[model samples]
Structure formats: structure tokens, C-alpha cells
Target: MIALGVWQLQRKGEKEALLALYERNRAMSSLATYPELPPVPDELLFRKSSVVCLDPVRWDPRSGTDVKGRSGFRMIADCRTGAEGPGVLVDVGISDDFTPPAWTGGIVQGTVVPGPEQPTLVERLTGRAVAARPMLVADQPVAGLRQSAIPSGADVPNNHLAYAVQWFLFALAALTIYIFAVRRRLRQ
Candidate 1:
């Protein structure tokens, strides 16, 4: 139990550091260009970036929240940056229409953010690593839609310290109870 508490403390420190790094990169005013797969820099997450999507393969309408926190549908464009490569997802905007729009493709300016998390069970099933893909949340809404929320690294949960405290409390309670039980046995 004590070891678990210590581990949570370590996790808290790591999460803080990651959030700091994300903020530092996002603070820059310069816009970064899209990189072709060779494993781009991890710092690219949460940074301002622009991508010229040559072709929008498909438009996915997903249930999401807008900038104003209104629950609705958001249009995600699955684009092929060039002739062929890894598809980059761009959250074009929020709309009431659950159906996809007629958007083809263009230069999309947005804040680079971490994409949706993939289920860990998928990686275990396939015996491979399946991580969240990087996505861009547009600074402006496309034609008829409204603005989608631009997320920050601070959005990541940081409750590890609180969890650590809970574990430590449990350990202390167990010890105290055991001591009382020993004293009662001696008296008997």
C-alpha cells in the first residue's frame, strides 16, 4: 500500500512536467508545418500548426461539445495530406447536423492537440501498440458550422496526489486498527 502511494506521487510529478512542456510549446506564436510520419517531435502536441490537406477522404460527424460547452456534433475531416500517407484528422467545427458536410479540403489553421484515445484492449488484441493519433482543432469554423473547443494539456486530469494521500490514509488506518486489536488480545 505504501509502495502504491509512492508510485502515485511519482505519477503526479510526471503529469505536472508533461503539462509544463505542453504549455511551453503552445505559447509560441509561430505556426508549425505538418511532418510526414517518421515520428514527429512530441512537442508538436498543443502547438499552433497549419496543414494543407490535399484531399479530404471522408468527413466524420461525431458527438462532441463546442467552445461554449454546448453538446452537439463536431465534423472531423479525415484528410490525406499528400498522394498517400497516414491520415490526419481535423476537427473542422461544431454543427447541429449529425450528417457530414460538403467540405472537400483546404489549408486548415488550428491548434495541434492530442486526438481521441484508442482503447487499450485493441493493442492487447492485436499484439501491437495503438496510441491516440494527433489532431488539429480549427481556430475558425468551416463554412456553416460553429467553433469547436481548443483543448490544452491542462485538460489532462492531475488527481494522482489526492489518490496517493488516500492510499497513505488507508495504510495508517490499517496499522492503527491492528495495534488496537493486539492491545485487546493482551487484555483478554
Candidate 2:
């Protein structure tokens, strides 16, 4: 149990460092250079950029939410830096209505975010696959909808310290119980 506690403490440090890196990335301004369609590194997760929408925007009703906790949906569509193949998915903005925006294909600016894991509930609700991973969080409003806030790593809770304390307490309780049992046996 002591060893487990120590491990959790180490994990806490790692999580803190990761959170700091995320903050730094979020603070950096949008990169003037956009990389070709490929795997983006962790360092570029929150980097901002402009992308031209190549395909029609599709709504992902499953993962939509507003800053005010209102029900909404994000517009998802394939986009590229220029006329090219292998465009990436972009999350345009959140809208309360289901109507598609008139500006379907155009240059949109936004920050990049890691694509969410496949949400089974969303897929079931929309009857379609969730938007591709590593989608963009648009900085501009679309179809009279407001842009959702880009998630910062700081919002992630670091509870490893609390977990470590719980483990140590459990070990201490077990040790006290054993000592009491030994004393009673000796007295008897």
C-alpha cells in the first residue's frame, strides 16, 4: 500500500506537468503555417489555424453543448488548407437549431483540439458515425450560433494526491488492527 501511494504521488507530478504543457499550447497564437493532412503532435493540440471547408457541414448532435449549459450541436465537416485531398474534420460551432448554415464551404479560423473518443450514445442518437478525431474548435460563429469555448487541460482534475492519502489510510488501519489483535492474544 505504501508503494502504491508513492506511485500515485509520482503520477500526480506527471499530470501537473502535462497540464502545464497544455496551458502553454493554448496560450500560443495561431500558427501562420498549417501542416499537411497528417497526424498532429501533442504539442500542437490547441494551436489555432485557418481551414477551408471542403465538404458540406454535418451536425453532431451527440457532443454539442453551449457555455450556458444549453442543448446544442456542433457543426462537423471535412476541411483543408487548400484544394487538396485528405482534409481534416472541423467543428464549426454550436447551434440550437438544426438548420445548416449558408456558408458551408469557406475559410474558417479556429483552434485545434483532439478528437473525442467514439461516443456510442452520440452515434446512436444521430444514427451516424461521430466526427473524425482531432477536430477543430472554430473561433468564429456560424449560422447565428456562438462558438463554444476550447477546452483547456487545466480543467482536468488531478486527484492522485487524494487517492494516495486514501491508500495510506487503509494501510494504517490494517496495521493498527493487526497490532490490537496481537495484544489481545498475548493477554489471553
Give Cα-based local distance difference scores for all models: 0.82, 0.72
Alpha-carbon deviation at 188 in model 2, angstroms: 4.8
Candidate 1 — worst ten consecutive residues by lDDT sum?
A: 31-40
Ten-residue stretch with the least lDDT total in model 2: 54-63
**Model 1 has how many clashing residue pairs?**
0
Q: Which stretches of candidate 1 lie over 4 Å from their true place?
A: 35-41, 121-127, 180-188
Off by over 4 Å in 2: 32-39, 67-71, 78-87, 97-103, 118-132, 184-188
Q: Per-residue alpha-carbon lDDT of model 1 for 110-178, expressed as tens digits?
A: 988767644488686888855667788899888888899888887888999999999999999999999
Summarize candidate 2's per-residue lDDT along 1-188 as a digit string, tens digits: 98999999999999998888878988898878554344566677777877777665354443576666665776666554455556667777777666655665677788877765445877869887544367777777676776776767866789999999999998999999999999999999
lDDT of 2 at 119: 52
What TM-score would every model get versus the actual structure?
0.86, 0.72
Tell how far residue 145 is off in model 2, in angstroms.
1.6
